[model samples]
Target: MDTSNEPHIAHKSHLPHPYDQDISHVLRHLSRITATGRKKLANSLSTAGYLAAGMWLIERNLGPDAARSACASGSRRSLERPLLGFLSQRAVAAAVAENPPPFPSRGGVPRLRTTWRSQSDFIADLINFAMWPTNYHPGYLEQRAVTTKRLVVGEDFVRAVHETAYLHTAESVRMPSVRLSLALMVLADGDDRVQRVLTDTYRGYLSSWKQVYAEVLRARGLRLRAGLGLDDLANALSAATDGVILRSIGDPHAGVVDRGRERTLMGTVALAVMHGFLEPAEDSDGLTLEQAVHARLGRPRPSGATRSDALRGERNPNP
Candidate 1:
């Protein structure tokens, strides 16, 4: 195949320009490349090395010898820019797909099974899907935290927080997409267009989380500590989650916990942060924090059960 007429091929296909043309064909071809080459791109030491590996993959898949010669003959820069664009777009798509907005209703019918009882449950479900994106089925996970008479920050809440941490830790360790997107962001440094896309995606991510946080708090009749704004809490949690995930990537053992442990590193940190920011609604029935949590979990409190036992995961009345 004559590769010099790549732009002409796009024009003939009625695409606007080579850079603006649909690159799904390129993506398909790239997908056929060996896993080792894709891994090389992810582990590349520099942007130039990453682009070089990408070009090699393109040449290998697009055409055997002709594409290589053409790529070497003063077309490298032209192809490199578009290839980077394609990658940036993919990174944005992956981010969006990973953090879909929760849908509470479908065709005017409420989704009861997916309804969340608290912010912890909502975030736990989010982490589950984020960790295993392949398992997420649209409409199956539509979740909305329902309004309740009182928000109990008790047993279910603590368990959900721990589960979120465990799943997110596993995601950081196992998801190649997360690492690859981080690599792309690093490579996109100083590139205004790519940076803009990343910035917009991040803003969207924060906005979605903030909305959820605000809604869940209001619905539960809860309030933040004095001088703590909703955006501040949301941003802090987002930053903390990102930091923990990055740490998990660097040290997988950071998320490790003993069997039957109730909290991972992330869960412990998140629980502390939540305690600092959140306060019970001003109303009747002033119960201790441990009591509230246990009551919400609906576990029959054993005689002589203490706060220490509750925190230690010994809530079983019969046991």
Candidate 2:
């Protein structure tokens, strides 16, 4: 009997360490698609209405080295447009056809049924909508705040995941300390506040977000982390102009920009979620390890170029 060809599967009870998980999942967008001439994947998701779990996985698996590939972008689109889950076992197998990860094999077995839910789903969604809110009413401003408020349901969702799926989200994603939690993370300062922050002037809010985040970091002094906090993180709340924040905290008159920017200064939130600044409320939307992987990662997109530019491919002779 030859036992050398055996494969191993990492169970939910044991996942990559939390910091590693964040590194691989969130930062993976910068990875190159592949050395075989693939596209570079986007660092974030397309329909960022919710945090794209697949993107998170890519950040975890791939690293800065893969950032140059365009193939990665296409893969992200594949996961984003339809909101589908992980790659088919065939797809995964096909990807690793020539050079597979040293990770244990599947023994020719299937990757098991996937459930596209996770503990980070809801608050992550809030973060998503906050980043880019399009197509809505003036009243949406009022409703949006309630939407981002951390849900009590997340706690039960976390427990259910622990008992049922056998998934092991890092403890950091589940915040144990509020002083160092996601609520304190800043999105933008002055011109950066995306979620209809009294859009009299866009530039001001975004600037305020940066200042506020810096203040929070200063105020909290490295004791916090990111995730859904007790505060309403979705409503573009900021410590920037208090008058704007006070007047617009629940204002029913505001515009949900049709083309909100995708990128945000959410590194704090990303760090917080990875470090347990946020806890699982009773109703956290549960996502399986599989769902998170698929949502956070992808195969990369092809270049839109129809004509190949030979000069572009060649190294700069001057350099």
How do the residues 238-284 of candidate 1 rate in per-residue lDDT, one tens digit apiece? Answer: 67776766665556566443225634576678788787667777742
What would the per-residue lDDT of candidate 2 be over residues 1-319, giving only the tens digit for each residue?
1223332322312222221122223221222455321121111111120122323323223221223323546764433321112223333333333222333233221321111122232223223322232312244435433322211123442332222111111111121111111221332223233223324223443464344334443433432222333232313333212222222222314311111331122322233332333223342323333333333342232466321222222223244
The top-ranked prediction according to lDDT is 1
Q: Model 2 compared with the native: what TM-score?
A: 0.20
Predicted structure with the largest TM-score when compared to the true one: 1
Q: Could you tell me the lDDT of residue 168 within candidate 2?
A: 11
The CA lDDT at 299 in model 1 is 83
